[model samples]
Target: MSDVAGTLPSTRPSFLRLPYLRWGLVAIIQLFLIAIPLADRFDVQRNGQVVPLELVPVDPRDLLRGDYVIINLAINSLSKDLSEGDKIAVGDKIFVGLQAGAGKAAQPVVVSVERDNAGDLAMSGTVRSLTENEIRVDYGIDAFFLPEGEGRIIERLDTSRVLLEIAVTEDGRSLPLTLLVDGKAFQSDAAF
Candidate 1:
């Protein structure tokens, strides 16, 4: 009762309110830190298809699996040549010619492949310096690379195992294109 009017009561906001602005600032900073480095990107092609992607190279917090490779597809990897020679036979250094179009790379076509004396498939030409039009490639499917029985958990050992030079036909124009595995292809899934 003695000068109680001069003193304030506890009816005001708590300490939590004061810290809300500071906490919010910290949260904003944290969000920016998390998002900035996530701006990296990549691209891939399958068959003659091109796949574009934007990704973060971090440990990758996934929706279900936690973390994994987000492979983007630029082409249908199963749609090889759109014609023939689907399998890489024994001792064949397959030659693949890339036709330009589907993506920034080539379209799709076949190049000459020869069997080396070591029983390896060797590419017969040169598109070694690839640009927008075409690329020549030697098949790395030789036994020395993949050995055959490793198609399960290891379909590709390195870029040499999966990278193939391909050619494609688009609107009567043939071009050379580079192709890669979108992963392995199963038979009869010929959306081809």
Candidate 2:
């Protein structure tokens, strides 16, 4: 062996070489952007009303995205008659009125295209795909990110007994709180 020690190559990226002030400014901006949405979600969880909706889980596995289950709420479909302006089109912001169903389950009572006309306990989502028969809404709570192997367990669960506990604001914003399996909280911050 030679007397000289082997020097390892530097692994730091070029961005790391920037001045401290520049890096600090970039970090502050990044944190602000990330915190804004999370702050809203957190606020809803703290003050929003809890609504339990039936869950229909679909298996989703991606190498880059890790594990998560795509969910379809039982309250997704609305058969209510819409007036001339009440018709929800694709990309429209709509409020879904919710009411307590059998055994304290939350069910979608109606879909109101207008915000002012939206009743109490309304949840908001953007209409993804719409047809005369049905309007598909993306409620932002569509996926439950799971840790490692947990996704498989949720995927194999009997969907009838599965419930998604969500927090909804009075103004129609919603944040998913937990996934309940067989009336038990699988992953949750709130009681089942």
The best candidate by TM-score is 2
lDDT score of residue 120 within candidate 2? 78
Instruction: Evaluate model 1: give its lDDT.
Output: 0.32
TM-score of candidate 2 versus the correct structure, residues matched by position: 0.77
Q: For residues 47-73, write the lDDT of model 2, one tens digit per residue.
A: 898888887899787777778888788
Evaluated with lDDT, which candidate comes out highest? 2
Question: How many backbone clashes does every candidate have?
Answer: 32, 0
Give the lDDT of residue 31 in candidate 1. Answer: 94
lDDT of 2: 0.76
TM-score of each: 0.23, 0.77
RMSD of model 1 against the true structure: 17.2
